[model samples]
Target: MTIKEKADEILYKTGLYEELKTYGEPHPIGSYRMDMMVYNDLDIDILNNSMTLEKLHTLTNYILKTFRPTWYEAREEVNDEGKTVWFHGFHAILMDELWNFDLWFFDRETITKAEAYCDTITTRCHQNPTLKTTITTIKKDLLTKGLYHYDKYTSMDVYHAVLTENITTTQAFLKTHPLTTY
Candidate 1:
């Protein structure tokens, strides 16, 4: 199946999208939001300020009961904005492939600013196909070479490398943007 179809299957068919809506507004980010799919992942940020233990428990419970995730983790922390945030991350075997999801739970105000920033990036890429192509190539090349790591780099890094730094190749990205930069 295609990338969008796979996302639809996991989000819509599996009812995760609707379930997330009950708590907050869930939306895509990074490559998924920009339609620059080069990896088996989805990045969703859910906006909710009043996140209660019961709400979290119910959502996670639903996920655990409804889906068979190969890996699952939940954590609460203070974000860079000094706002309390929660993260629900998981990887599941879907369509015979490992699919990763980053479910960031944050207050609506905090997430709105982030979403707006992502929107700017998305719009910029959409308006310039050549820029978008350059971006996806760098991302795909790095992933294919096993250069991307969860603890190291991300698609956002690639975008930053290209859009801001004008670095287009995999080598340049690795050389210019170090692990610490991410």
Candidate 2:
């Protein structure tokens, strides 16, 4: 199955969205939103400040027991926007493939700006249809060369390169910005 198909299976069929609704709204972001998915990575943005520390744990517990992911982790960190977030990320072998899920929890105040930024990227990718192809190519090449590390960069960086700047090739991307681990 394609990534979209598997995504739907995991999102709706697994009742992931319904479970998430107990805490807040679940909004898929990044490449998933832009239809530029190059790998088995899913990004979710949860807003409304409804997911408190306690609720976050309860939800994660449910995920752990139900999904039985190979591994999972949680963190509290400040985003690039300087807004603190509760991040619950996990990796699992699902549908005979390894999938990464990034669940970002944010308050209403923080989500407003975050959603707008993601929407802008989605809009830009939609406008320039070719950008999606270029993005997937760049991402696929990076992955093939073992140069694309999730910890080092994000889809936002990729979108920024293709949308704001004219950086295209993986070589150009590497030279233009230091896509390295912190």
Candidate 3:
């Protein structure tokens, strides 16, 4: 099967595809366990104080335990200034070995703008056939360089860079952003 078909199958098995189609894309909040952004639509102040964070932690823990993932992992990295920062969320192999996904939860007041941005990217990709191949090549190169992560950079960023800056290859992209990890 094609990569997109494989991804769709995985999402369907994990139930995320259904949830996303029903409720839209979820907003990410960085923390111990990645919490689903379900609470974002509520009045809860996810970032206000420690109490809210604690509650979110508890909720996330409960969800994780209930899911009973095969295994989970977290990452940490040091920034340019030398302070170590843990990456915001956990990577989970949920249900089975094939179901690898990230979990992040936090509260955001609105996801309309983010969702719109996603739609724009999708539309752009559909309009520009070559754009998808360029993005895929860039992602593969970034993965080989060990810099393929949503937190590191995104396909949308790469797409915009290629369109606006005339970046034709991954090497060109790296040249443009010398400070980037890749």
Candidate 3 lDDT over 59-125, as tens digits, reads 4464366445455453444546564333223334432333334532222322344445555655666
Q: Model 2 residue 70 lDDT?
A: 90
Candidates ranked by lDDT, best first?
1, 2, 3
TM-score of 3: 0.55
> Which candidate comes out best when scored by lDDT?
1
TM-scores of all candidate predictions against the true structure:
0.90, 0.86, 0.55
Arrange candidates by TM-score, highest first: which order? 1, 2, 3
Q: Compared to the true structure, candidate 1 yields what TM-score? A: 0.90
Clashing residue pairs, candidate 2? none
Superposed Cα deviation of residue 12, candidate 1 (Å): 0.6
lDDT of 3 at 158: 72
lDDT (10s digit) by residue, model 1, range 1-182: 77866887888998899999998889777667777888788888898887877877887888788778889987778877788888888888888899998898877676678778778888887788778888889878888888676767777788788889988778888889766652
On TM-score, the candidate that comes out on top is 1
Off by over 4 Å in 1: 178-182
State how far residue 104 of model 1 sits from its true place (Å). 1.4
CA RMSD for every model? Answer: 2.2, 2.5, 9.0
